[model samples]
Target: MVTLKLLLAISTIKQWHTLQIDINNAFLNGDLNEEVYMSLPKGLTVSLSSCADPPLVCKLHKSIYGLKQSSRQWYTTLSDALLSAGFKQSQADYTLFTKGQDDQFIALLVYVDDIIIAGPNLKLLHQLQHSLHARFKLKALGTLKYFLGFEIARSERGLFISQRQYTINLLEDTGYLGSKPAKTPMDPKLKLDNIQGEPLADPSQYRRLIGRLLYLTLSRPDITYSVHTLSQFMSAPRTTHLQAVHHLLRFLKGSPGQGLLYSSTSSLHLRAFSDSDWAACPLTRRSTTGFCVFIGDCLISWRTKKQPTISKSSAEAEYRALAATASELTWLQYILADLHIHSSTPAFIYCDNLSAVHIANNPTFHERTKHIELDCHFIRDKIKAGSIRLIPVRSSLQLADAFTKALSSTSLNSHISKMTVHDIHRPS
Candidate 1:
């Protein structure tokens, strides 16, 4: 997903043309070197040879959909073909292939059989598509309006990627299309727990709903905190948990088209914000880490997750969040380098906790922090290597604050806009 976002960001910046292709029956194109036999499918009458043919069975020559190795075989075939075409596979993301340099550069990202091709050279893209079509059954999807549930809108300003229809479909399926709109996805005072509500008669529906919402977070970072909160109760969701899910649906109904907008004028420099909520989880008393990464003004990556261990202090929690953000920034730098976008300036990690900032900058380790020594060491190493810089910021201005806790409408709206989230299709 990071690779895809980076591709779109670069395309927006370079004014490149983006195209999509779908390989027909992609798994069927795999060449099988092993022998496999299957019972003849029902209703297919094989011609009897001299009326003495043994009980009929079929021998497979190529990969089939149900085979365990089908996906790997198909990818091997695709990789071989792309590598043969002089395209270099990205070390950061093997699914990405690049060719040429400068204005002639081309990038092709493949997820299974669905491929997104982008480049400044239109002729080269077409020629490559033609070449792919020659080797495999290819369906050229012009202009890349939709791919993998993300509706992409392109203009001179930039690209807007959303799951508007997906969101509406979910709302409709859950009977929330006509529900009252929610100013926020979750109530600021709501504290959910496993034992607070009655066990649902049927928990499968709750599980399924949470699963879909998890996918929705790909574009709707606004609900990421709420979704992450509700997801914890999936095992045996209660009435209260289901109600929270419905509340989230109401929020989605308000702006089904809200999504990330990658601005064309955005710079290529990387920056990030890290935050943590101390003892946020009611049941576990564990801190929650939240972070968002941006390439220039465009937000590309963000996450809301519970800390793996209990934090002894707020500083510990905040430092852990900084370490998590630093790791992500390092990864983004690698990916940016793979995309041929490099910045000599070290990426900045903004934290609202001054104690965490001081600890990160201080070389001396204390006995109280021995349990968290690993995280501390990792963060200091990043800072010393010039890969990241830890800076303290005001809590009110921390963009990742939304990810760690439920916020008032005003605060969420402010962070939403700053994160480049737009609702061009919001209902009146």
Candidate 2:
């Protein structure tokens, strides 16, 4: 999904036309490499008149749906075909393939059977489509309206991607279609702990809900923090945790049509914001790291995860968060380079902690800082190489603050607005 969004954002910047293709019975196209046999079914038995004891098995020559290696085999076949067609596979993302150069370039992103082909030249895209169809049966979806449950709408302004139908179906499945809407996904004052409440009667239900919510975060960044918080309790969910999930569902009910808008007018510059909630986990006393990356004004990537190691100081936690953000920025830079878009200016990474900013720039390391030396060096290397610049921003203006912790309704809306997260169905 991160790669998909990045492609869409770059395509929007280039004003490229995107097309979709679905391979029919995509798995069956792969030729079997090893000799494999399958037992014949009860009704489909071979005649035994020609032999004393006829074999009740058949040798498989092609990949099938139930085969364990079907996906890998299909991918190998597809990769071979694309490689033969002059497309270079991306090291950053194996599923991505690119050909041509400059204005005549074409990019193809593969997700199992579904593919998205984007380029500025319509003739080249059609030629590629015909070529792919000749190799394997393909159903051209045409003009990239929907793929992988995301509904895409393009206009003169830009592209709008949403999961409106998916959200509605989820609400209906959970019996929350007519439920009252929630102003916020989670209560700002709530502190969820593992030891306080009794386990739910059915842990599987809580796990399933969390799984769906995690997918929902793909298009809804506002619920990311709440979903991350609720996901922690999936193993032994209590009534309180289930209630929190219910709250998130109600929040989704309020605006099921809300989604991301990728604007053509947005610039191509890269910037990111990093923040942390020091010792936020009640169970392990570990801090939570949150960061968001932007390509021009569009938010391309964001994450909220609890740190694996406990930091002794707030600066250590913030520094670790900055390191994570820097890693994502480095990968984004590589992706942009693959697209032939070079960043003339260094990416600006905003941090709320001044000590962390200093730690990234400072070469001196003490005994207390030795544990985080790896992270410090990684961030400093990027800084010294002029790939990124760490700047301290006021906590009030920190866009990643909402990702680290639950925020008040006012503050949450403020940050969402700044992130360009809006309901496309709302009146302009």
Which regions in candidate 1 have their CA more than 4 angstroms from the true location? Answer: 30-59, 373-376
Candidate 1 lDDT tens digits, 75-153: 9889999999999998878999988887778899999999999999899899999999888888998888998999999
- lDDT for residue 90 in candidate 2, whole number 0-100: 89
Every model's TM-score: 0.93, 0.94
Model 2, stretches more than 4 Å misplaced? Answer: 30-58, 373-376
